[model samples]
Target: MRRRKLHNLQEEFINKFLETIENNEEYLEFINRHKPELLSNCDIAIREVKFFDVFNNTQLNNLIKGISNLNKEKYSIDLSLMSKKYKDLNYLIIQYDNSSTRSLCEVTFKDDLFINNVRAGFTQINNNQAVVEFSISFKEIMTHNLWIDFIKENKELLYGKKFFGYYNIGEMIKSAHFALIYNSISKVIDAALQAKLLSVFSLNFGNEYTLPQYNAIHVPQEHFKKEYFDNMFLCRTYEINNKYLIVDITSDEGLKMDLYFSGLYSSINFLQLLARYRMDLYYFLFEKIERFEINRRVNKYFLNSRKRIALKDYRWLINKIRSLNDNKLRENYTDSRELLEDWKSFYDGKEEEFIDFENGQYTKKYNTIYSECFDHIKMAYSIQKENLVIYIATLSLIASLIGIVTTVLLG
Candidate 1:
């Protein structure tokens, strides 16, 4: 969470990765010959943490109270006394008392960072319907080379691990519940999720001297003047728009300030929250996939209804974004306008890709349902027609018999 240590580690990793690649003769020759300016911009990778257990409003309230009154054990959940039906105890929200630490994440919730603002609870996610979420965030400034295995490596870190819930391993208690199952998750182990890392490769590398190398990105000079800030020496801002500003510092100290100001301290926070849209997309596909594999007799009506509901939901969401983008909600981010634009392009492109994928998936499923239903209808119609033909023949034969009998009697 401390800036200096993270900065040094990233610097070391980048240099190590690049230097190690010297063993690759072809790559070395190409870089030497070409003298290519290899600069990778910083990237922020947002990750999500979720639990499958569902918590009703009452349970959510109970958890909130327990977190609020951390000094008391009265609200502490007793595993033995609770119902067997109760699975894992999950937190919809955890509001640590006035002692909770504050950081960039607090800014996302519009809370002050220096003081522990108990009002701003750490949120792993913005969704109030969550089963449990402990949102803790900090930043990483990585070079492109480091990304080769940086994320995977980061996952193994116990950097900021903390126990947020209750547990007693003594007295044959394996967890918060069911000793045999021992699967009760009152603790979110290895809690830090590597939500995002910002890579710092410059788009314009050669012009490092004339102007700030990181200052290659341009915006209209009128909006974001460097002098507009309270302490110009601490950081610089390049205008992205009326609402958005870009960080324009060339040094680590400068980047730190840029990270704070342009990042709005909570930029990653906002992003992590927005990232939930992805969860919906994944869940929708997951449900359909499960249905296909597990349910042998998927009904036509259910398929049709699902198809319509998904289409409508996506359409509404897309339209909502369009409306927002029309006027455009403005926010700023670090090190050049290019980095900010990259985030926008990344989000927009992914949104479109996901929507397109869902449309294709649901469309295919609906067609399968319709085809099966149509075949059944056709078979039923054929059977009814055959019965009608047999009935007509029987009536004609009876009439013929009656006519013959009448003729004989008359003669």
Candidate 2:
């Protein structure tokens, strides 16, 4: 049985390689020149290894040997280049591998033949299928006003015929953004086109967009209607003057399109801008949680709830706690010793006996619920911070009045 499994795995790998080479001319040429025998061996092996126990030790050894000899050097996934095609526009991309460890990099460049460069680390986790990261600083792009001027100055170059060259900026941006939410990206594109809000702009382009193919642009508000049940924001699109465009996006509660628009590039740098906006919010909340030393308790709360607390439940908890701030009930704590003992009983090498497939499905359902609950909590935090600031300012003003009164009485 094990022999068959290994052979089947090898067959799948071979099929993938064949398909890749057949579809990609560059790869096909590389394979033909370096390893013709490897391809033939794969085809023959598939015919011989059909049954569960067919492959003996020698056959398995030969299969491994043939694969190792293939010209795999040409298929390396790495970010090999970052160069500006336009005078003002700079491009950044890395060849990515989703099958392995996460890859992160820092991008830096400047105008006027490479001046002082800045560096920031970018780490991309798998959103689903595409390996994507949002560490690039879109704030580096000039404001919307300057971008307009740049577009006017080089409309023909950015949107003209010359922009269709290799490594096109338009395609890259689309690829990058689509990587973030590829499953829903097509819906966003369709909605944007229906709204008729497609346009390209750049402050540093010499008609680069015109030279390359442009992917359909999308804005979230153009499509998604605010649903009462969706406690988190999904990708959406909006229409302006009969043209479909992306207007707003919601990820978590603290993240909104308005917050992103407030940053430097409200429109031109869409993907990177959204990423920067999310990072700011994520880090902001992370710092607050760490500073308050609430990670352990919050995490425990999530686990106990089976990660399925509803949005309404989240609001209720926050409001109830807010009302009970000074009450002894707020300070009352449950001793965890008994709970720990119970957990330990399950931990003693008997987890497999108790946990069935149904538990996995149940966990997923609850996880969504728990995520929505956290979104509401984040919104509550934002409100709490605003109130805190107002309270401090009011207290300061009152103290100043008391000091002024005391001085006058003494005089």
TM per candidate comes to: 0.25, 0.19
Model 1 segments more than 4 A misplaced: 1-22, 31-37, 40-140, 144-268, 271-411
Candidate with maximal lDDT: 1
For 133-221, candidate 1 gives per-residue lDDT tens digits of 22323233222333334433443232222211112322222222232212221011212111111010011110111111111122223
For every candidate, C-alpha RMSD to the true structure in Å: 20.8, 27.7
* Candidate 2 per-residue C-alpha lDDT over 1-411 given as tens digits, one digit per residue, 9 for 90 to 100: 354554454344333322333454544454466464333222211000000001122322332233233233422112322323222211222222211222222233233121122111222211211112222222323332332333333323212122122222234333443222222322222222111111211111112111101122222332323321122234233322232222223222111121111112222222232122222212222222222223333544445543343455456445433222212221211231221222111121122232111112322333344456567566655666788799999999999999999999999
User: What is the model-wide C-alpha lDDT for candidate 2?
Assistant: 0.28
- lDDT of candidates 1 onward, in order: 0.29, 0.28
